[model samples]
Target: MTATGERNALDPEPIQSRLRALLDHHPDGPLPDAALRQIRTSIAPDHRSRPPSTGTLKERAQRHEAESAAARAELIESIHAVDPTPEGLLEFGRHVRRNVEPSGFASNMGAAEFAMAPGAIRAAAEHLLDTGTSLAEICIGLNLLSLAPRDGDSERIRIFIPLGRRIEGTAIKALGRIGRAGPHLAWAAERTPVYRRLGAVQAIWDLPEREFSELLYALPVKQSADLVQMFSALDSRPEGLQGDRRFARILRDAARPGALEAEPEALALAAQLWDEVRYGRCALLGFAPGEREMTTAGFQALLASPEASASVDAALAATPEDPDLVWLRMRLNRAAHSDPPLPRGLAVRVSVPRPSIATQARTHLLLDGVPLVEAHFQRGHSGRPETVLHDGRGLEALAEPRDVKIGDTGCVEECCGAFRAVISRRGGLVEWEVRDTVLKDPPTTRLTFDADQYDAEVVRAAADFDWEWPARRAARLLRERIGAESELMSRWECELAWTGSWSPDRSEMQYSFYYPKRPSGNDAYVQFSAARDVPYVPEVDDGAVMAVVDRIIADLRTTDPKSTARLSGGSREYAEALGFPWPP
Candidate 1:
């Protein structure tokens, strides 16, 4: 049969198996030309024209909701009518198997449970858990038990935790909803196959703080990306590692001697913790008192050891731009620096303005108190004087002695063709070499700085957050408080877009919310304006901003819900990437 015909006639598994065999037979070299042509034809995209979609996204969504509601109603009626007889329940399970799509079946069961009495639902669910023969019946039982969780429901759910992916996934969800499932979830998180442990970790993520912290401390460090995500989630939480000496000890142990070489993820986690401390996102000794001193000493010790330094160098070579590795390199540089003579007259300074509700914190670089770009370039620049060096890390990059491009002319470099500067250090002097300017007579072709003075000023500027804007500070607080991976964010239909307007009086900060999952035309937004102002006052603004965020989250719980759960997870990265009206 032709490849297309075979694909149409047989199951995908057999076709995949055949393809795998074909590739394996020729593992030594490239496949024969005829075979390659055949493979290409088999997997080629179908270019056949088809009718365009008929309805708008809103219309389609409304239709789907109506259908789902009707189907759920029918499921409720069928399950409600089932005689308490075993045979009747078995037949009802068969009915569900025939009608409901597997993808939606579990949720349907849970939704239907809401329409019936808790006792009735629990009794039916328990029956299925205890004696149901089919997978469908048992899954339905698990879903129902999730909503009407009893003291022993978790035990019943635990039975199916190791069955397989589909069953275990449903089982995990059910256990997560049960308050008593902590022990079981922890057990599963540790004992389950590495690939399957993410579900277990997520299930236990919302456990009581004490239990969660204890479990986090006890959990063995693994090299799974899921564990990295778990670490990220932990770092984002305000209470994470705070006043937890035991957990801090666990982290310190992970960073000991060769631990980072064995598991690179430990390094990432360490860097995240260090970043939190450096940025003042968390308490200095919240994890363990004197952690900063311990960490610095450890890093210095690593630098002293040739073998450890080699391993770090190798990792840095592999991922040079990795923020964790970059931070490590910076630390190493700091440790190695000797007291050099202070440069005369030249200084590096930055002006970071308070972000208004409608604007972002614009950072401008200055040399000896003179604006670098604004003072030199007139045309092709935004009068706003916003430079690219917004984050402290950007300033760190600027401090490096290598030739670095700071920012281009405000317009597109390829089109308008304006001059760019290559900032580099030669001997004790730092020089900015200007190139590609349209003006024959530019203001100045070069600007110079003293290398020692430049490095000190940049480092000082990067560490100082005194000039930070209130809106940006509020965003950081929200990230720490709500957590980037919090289940609460998953409930929102719209992602929190970072672009917002500050009221003219700077009294309120408004944020734009976008529905990324929806179609282009249907991706509507709602404005979330908080009562706050520029120049953050910790005492007055923090509580007020949190209250506003709380209100927004509460509103999303009802208005947005699960139907619009997108992958953005309300992360700042996702929001910025969506191309909303971001402030400069």
Candidate 2:
């Protein structure tokens, strides 16, 4: 019987008799066999020695509580041993597993241990960063090192790349489910130097030659030029270029001509770049008053130094001029215009007369005296608006972001372009895109379309567009041009520096900086899938490519009756129709 039961039984007796019997122990049992058995059980060695049944609610709960306390204590103690404190939990865990796991103790420690000491982990990271200490030494010293975890051999692998100025080889090695392109690369980008250099080069190498040319001028002149040479050696070959033609052209621009009559060739090179230009910034050379096009005057200034012999102007003006340069200049000028130049921020309204047929609608966005984004828009009718009543009849009460339409059709136009698209049940969406980067803004400029206003015919004069580069377009062209795998890798170096990240899902019909994430800074890679085929891009001057993209963008932006020719948004269809050789 329980102590309570015994007490209750005693209470049933008279107070005097119960007290006397409890004190004497003789009257309590009364010598009955059953009573004797109960007494014997209470005092028996076997029964006394047995553990408590623990079946009662309080006893069971107490047992569980004791066990839980023990578990918590173990976890806390374990955490204190390996990581006495913690700041970044996952990072701390990584450090501990990497440094401490080799010792015999850490493997034995439980999860609660990791949960206990947050400060210790932070200390470890600081120590790791500050002291060039070996993690293995720390683990062994802490008595945490031991054999690897059961499956750790399969799940984990070491990375050998160094960052900053100290690192040597940085080839990414594959492990488990992760490829050589490890996730650590993403994290390394923040703290490691190895990745930053690779990423910068990746951005530019992938773009077109003209943009790359402009990019060189924008890059830290010395450092940027060195990177460009490295890229040339790696990507393509040109005159005196060890790699290929694109890099050769870049090197040619970077060079200061030797003394004598090299003036004409230098001027020719300048003209080629000026005509084919695309995207790039020239903060390196300072600014220009007009749209910074290369001119004969500029050429004269460059070649007028004391070392130069013969009049640069006379050599260039010689009747038997370099036919190759002349042809290049002509081609670039033609590429610079659309049927009519695009207009920017110029909104006009016209309801679809049929309200169902889709026609090409166009617009231009201007920036820095140039049309930036231009394309055909799709237009359609919008539905009527309404409002929700307070009555909880139609809508659910728990839902968020309440939606209601009101019955009003205001003529107010939104900054959001709803008028660009005139949709129908039959045709699909048509959007504006940057086909060329050369046209002056406000869409249809008299200068952009007035072929008669030019001092010379298209074939004779170098295009008047700015020759500065745009890196993104260069990347597109490079990817299209080179067939070599290694060259392909280097193409993105410049582009990555400009755009920040890379994306493979580019639309053939559309062109823009189409990265997967809006980068804090660009990260271009030289690798591509084996199945992809990069088209052959030509070796036109960097300025000429820019001029072409610009002209094409501007020329496609108008709906005027004067439209004689236009480049299509789906450039492939246009190319097929025109049968013109694509710019490599």
Candidate 3:
């Protein structure tokens, strides 16, 4: 104040007096006096500690990376203490999985930590393989290698551990033992762990000739589908799983009289399925082939397959009427334009109510969402419900409907005038006409039906004739071979008759067997019936049909010695004409 004449800014007495006056002016202010008194103490340099301003984003990221790197360094150092033995490797895998970042890419902490130290990883894997370590341990080692960042040939590592990890010496020896242990794979499947068992099964195609033959014989028919899947997974090139030599061997073994006699339908289906898969076709048969047809070279290769003859023989003996099998037979014979043009997206529906003592009933037939025909019938008290038709309203609507009978029961109902149906295509428009006045009722009943209807009828008849045999066989197979849970069941009634039939207007098969508890003579014999209004497929030789009859008769004989075998009443005369021994 004396030197510059400025107000005495450092004067404490004046400063205190000014503050007191200001505070007194605002005594009822927001803050209480006690709060004001403690403000200086609360905000003193010693007490004030708000965080300082953060650095730039790049700077902050750099700091985080450094810290993470240090932490990872510490983790790796700790993991290194674990020995590179099988047990140690498992522990390391656990550690890596636990620490792996969500993004899978972290400079400081990531699966790359394992890749950086391949020495330990490889050593542990080799040690596990050398030692007869458990499959789980080997899997853990392989998983670690798979997950590690790929610095080099990651595929090589995978090859070393194969999906089943069966490359180990012990595993290989065990697999060899399985091949020598006869055809039944159940034992091997049970003895080994899941992965090792699967590995052994996959090696079936590569087994020696004798071993392969044994395996096929021992392979359960129920497991045939599974075997096909495994075989399909193998190499499918011409020289691959379907090569001439191997396919021939498989066909010969499967077609052997013994194999066929044991599981006729299953073995045939398996062989056919194998061929289909080898040819790059779906395993399921009956459907039309896709757009891509095989080239001449591929066709020639199929022709040259050693098993071609055997497969044909089996088809004839097993399922001759199967459209797919019949077509396969013709194709193998180098027949021209043998493939049938099966309609796509065709669905068949049949509504048959549970039969009672009623005298009259009706059955409706639908094909691909369109009503084709209805069969109204009045069965004599003792006879089967006879199907009859009157006006051809539904038939005329079809592309080409033939054979219009008001009440035709396939058999000679009354030669007054049998019916005939004509189906044809004109300018891509299908026409079906049923003629009720066709004079020519052939001396023998020659029915014409579509391929689907024919195939469905055959299947239905086979299922119905001696039905108990299949049911028993399936139950036994499930119990003895597969060890499936199957308890004994009881029958409450005597089976009498079954309805196995089909209609030309629909591609559906109908089957139902009658069972009655009463000892009435009405339920005396097993009556099976089937109707056909379509022509039998030309691709299938008559021999196949004979084989099916023989099998049915054999089953009937086994099931009931005194009973007469009548498969599809319409076919009885045909069976007799062919010397099929069906009535026996």
Candidate 4:
């Protein structure tokens, strides 16, 4: 009021002069007493102070900031009195709220403070890992230590589990030092010693069946103790794995001979698993069906269909207790009434036809009426082109070998290759065929049968074309056989060492080196590494192992297929170390 010559309602000074100034400025008289009281209450306390600061608002703000900074400095010094270990920091963080509330001070802290002392943090983390405190708890402690926002616990775990090299500003960075030694270093640092020992075993969960066989030769006998412990921990098991035979096979592979003989729980699990696999596989592979347990009415109704009744009768005659019978019945019933997806169209188209007249002649392939690829022949020949059928769209197609005319010429004919389906780079399906001949290209034909026939054939082909399951089965069988027969010949332990990056097309190469435990032999124990294109995988029951085993036996059989003699020679025991009960 004094400086601007305006009325100030909250002012303690007399308002007569201000009221006169207001009257001069406005034709209306002074505000009413009720309105004046409200205006005084609405005015800010600082604005109505006895006298405003002689300095401007900016200068006063700077002075207040300086005073707040001094108070915050004192608060930080008190916080620093607390020890900086994980537990200490946790307690300090709790106390910070009381200090902040009383001082009316607020400040943001750097999240990196948690990682300031790597040694202390590492020690604390080691203690936590040993105690089985999960990564989630560790992250929460870290956030509190660093005074960072504590949110996204699940997101932090997801990011930490799959972290690779090149982690920066991430919780993983604070967990361990970024050494060039594989990205798994952090994972190892954060797990129990038992879990650390089984890191390679856990890889089985991610690897494809073909690579699973690598586990046979990879694990050392020294690690068996830890592996057995892990199996014992899993004895209670999950409900979903009630009839899962593959899991049983894994347990058996981990346990040494006579190891689980005393473990009744493990033994029971193994027996149940064996029954499930032996009979269930037979049912799934269409080898045969077993008996059914049904009410009288159900049995009579089943008898109404001669085929179903015959199937049931055959199952009854096959085994006294067919463990897979229940599962098979359920699956068959579901399949009979299932509504599955159909191929909307073919996946691939032929860029060009094979077997040009002047150029080398060959054939082209198509899937679902669409052309996929062309195969060029080394040399041209004359005859009617080979008969090719698109059949129809499906998950898979079987190649039927057929005698085909070489070209337009009738004089010569050759056995043509089979057709199969594959995915293209553009996420489309493509049909492929092996071109073993130098003759004319194979003919491409669309589905010729009626809609009903086409649908039936397509569904039938799809039904029998589950390659993934077969691969898993073969893996399991190989692991079981290998686990039963294979042993460390050398007394010393062997280590599984990875040689290169992971690749989908080829197996990862792993080599094992063991020093002779016997004093008499200076010979080195060297296990064969994977072939150039093969990857290492843990053994499981699957069809992928079947193909791998077939290849192994085929290569070995080149010399002697009938001989049950295992591959025994040199300081290293060859394929015989994992030979099956019967000749390949």
Q: Which candidate's lDDT is highest?
A: 1
Each prediction's Cα lDDT score? Answer: 0.48, 0.28, 0.35, 0.30
Largest TM-score belongs to which candidate? Answer: 1
Put down candidate 3 lDDT per residue, 420-442, tens digits, no spaces. 33544344344344444424543
In angstroms, the error of model 3 at 261 is 31
Model 2 local distance difference test score: 0.28
The digit string of per-residue lDDT tens for model 1 on 327-418 reads: 34434443354322223443333222111111223334544433344334443321121233432234332445443334344456566545
Which ten residues in a row are the worst by lDDT in model 3?
A: 374-383
Give the alpha carbon lDDT tens digit for every residue of 300-360 in model 2.
3333443232434343356323333332233233333322222222211111100001111
> By lDDT, highest first, what's the ranking?
1, 3, 4, 2
Q: Which ten residues in a row have the lowest lDDT in candidate 2?
A: 349-358
TM-score of each: 0.37, 0.21, 0.25, 0.20
Better of 3 and 4 by TM-score: 3
